[model samples]
Target: MKSFFSNQFINKTSLILLSLFSFSLTSCLDKEGEAPEPTPVAYVTLYHGAPDAPEFDILVDNQRLNSQPFKYNNYSDYLRFSTGSRKFKFTPVNAANSYVDTTLTFKENKLYSVFAVNRLQDMEVLVVSDTVMTPAAGKAGMRIIHLSPDAPAVDVATTGTTGTSITTNLNFKEHTLFKDVATGNQTIQIKRTGTNEVLLTLSDVALTAGKSYSLLLRGFQTPPTGNTNILSGQVVTNY
Candidate 1:
């Protein structure tokens, strides 16, 4: 019999890429012609958060995962993958040398986001789970992550600190737990910690009922010549 991992893969041909809060169910058959036990599976997404890094190709267990070179600030839809010890490699597009080589276990039935973060010199993979309490009636869930490598500590708020705090003192690579908030449009500001100096402001941001989101603080505070984008906030739908 072909043991699991040797002949096991989601969606048969490969991974099942799901979007937002979604799931895909599939089964496999053993070499004996009988249905095998259900293999543990998980959902994962890849993100290129390294602004100054070259385009990369993602590989898992010696298999190429992305058809195109994953570019800077881009992210892939959640893909269903087999659970257990998995090796990941990120190499420059069409290049033989890998910039990142790491491994992480994916627990069964969990959601994950794998980020290639920081500048090229300090690039690394940062993985995080995507589970949160369900939003109550008329509310939405949200959280913020600080991913700008060269950025100073910051705070995110709708109004001045006090009771309007969404996140505080969030440093590079730091992420906040999901918090439920009232649904509607509101302004968001990324300010220097403990002060009113705003670095970036988002206007009329919408939070829909019964949904969740991840607010990413990415890019460079002082972008290099080749990369012109400055510090900004990106919203990723979690569910």
Candidate 2:
């Protein structure tokens, strides 16, 4: 009877050892099968600057990126994108064909701006680097992008005619590097380059200290009657 109890105790110990070994093997397999996390992402902001074009869905490498359609003068906040060479497509809402198909390279830890410019008949995507360093105390970084397809080259004045133009002769599809501006209610004037004639005025735009901004000129100088897309000035914040 003592020998029989000794055999039962040994069998129970062996079963427990086998169960633990099996659990250890399963854990090893699970760790080996797990996928590595994705890396090297960039931030991008998309804009639909094409006048007379319908709302569009932004795609990357055949995958839809935007949650909804974007129209003229509409833009998005910074969104995460995988870094590398990427094919960007701008397709109309509920349509399969793309109007602007282009490939752009994005580096990791950088910011980018993608714009759909020109009229629909000759539309294309233009990519701009948006990387910026934080400005010094009490200063804000500012820049201008010329997106008006039909408008001529223009000068941007942060202060009416008294001070130098913020930028000059900035034509279609062109953008200037960021310049520092004092934060306050700034009176912006868009004038014909080298001339005092003003084309548009953005009254008392408030620029906050320690921030960055892009002043964009978009739409047409002469828009179609009743069309909301007109020659305009906009300040986009880059935080």
Candidate 3:
């Protein structure tokens, strides 16, 4: 009878230990599968396109931007922010009141660009959802924006020697959808709508595969006497 009791105790103890070991292993595996929370953020860039407007400062949720006031034709690099709704205020330099105020909601991991456009007193912001997707192998993406308030409607095409039209009839304050192009040195010619007269020619523009870009045409086609603003073109790396 003593031998039977001894055997029973041994079996019970072994079973309990086996169960505890199994439970411990399962807990460790559960921990291994779990990961830390991911950080949520959005990317944005700013452009100053308003002619006749002075330099301006930016405030987000009442917090002033760290950079200096943006002057005409100025652009900022991509800035990071937490993903959510935030208020944006644009104030002229040394001014107490804001020139423009609006609320913007941004999604995590997305890219955006904001442009301060038009003349002062009629100034407005244009927000563009930027695509950061890599183009196909050996291809690049290009987009054009016409921001010259006094310029005529125009078409953008490859140089007279090669390629084809990329955008047509792009008017003031208009922007084109992104178009994929072969990656290499490129030339673009801008012409007035329904006419063959080339208004601008961009020579030897470099394009790289898997990259995106934006070309902006700015300023007045014909400025008043003594006006310092001249018609110009600029390119920006989007991603």
All candidates' lDDT scores? 0.78, 0.78, 0.75
Model 1 ranges off by over 4 Å: 1-34, 160-163
Candidate 3 accuracy as lDDT: 0.75
RMSD (Å) per prediction:
7.2, 16.7, 18.6
lDDT for 66 (candidate 1) = 68
lDDT of 2 by residue, 84-164 (tens): 787888988868898988889988889999889998989998889986868779878889999988899999877854343
Enumerate residue pairs that collide in model 3.
none
Put down candidate 3 lDDT per residue, 90-183, tens digits, no spaces.
8977676877898888888898888888767778888888876676788888888998888899998766454867898999888987788766
Model 1, C-alpha of 174: deviation from truth (Å): 0.9
Of 2 and 3, the candidate ranking higher by TM-score: 2
Relative to the true structure, candidate 3 reaches a TM of 0.78
Off by over 4 Å in 2: 1-38, 160-164, 224-226
> Which of 1 and 3 is the better model by TM-score?
1
Off by over 4 Å in 3: 1-39, 224-226
TM-score of each: 0.84, 0.81, 0.78
Per-residue lDDT of model 1, residues 1-239, tens digit only:
01122234434325432211123322333356654445577888888899888888888876777666778777877777778778899998877689898988988899888899988987899998988568879878889988898889998876433225788899998888888766678678899999989999987678899999888999999998878768999887788
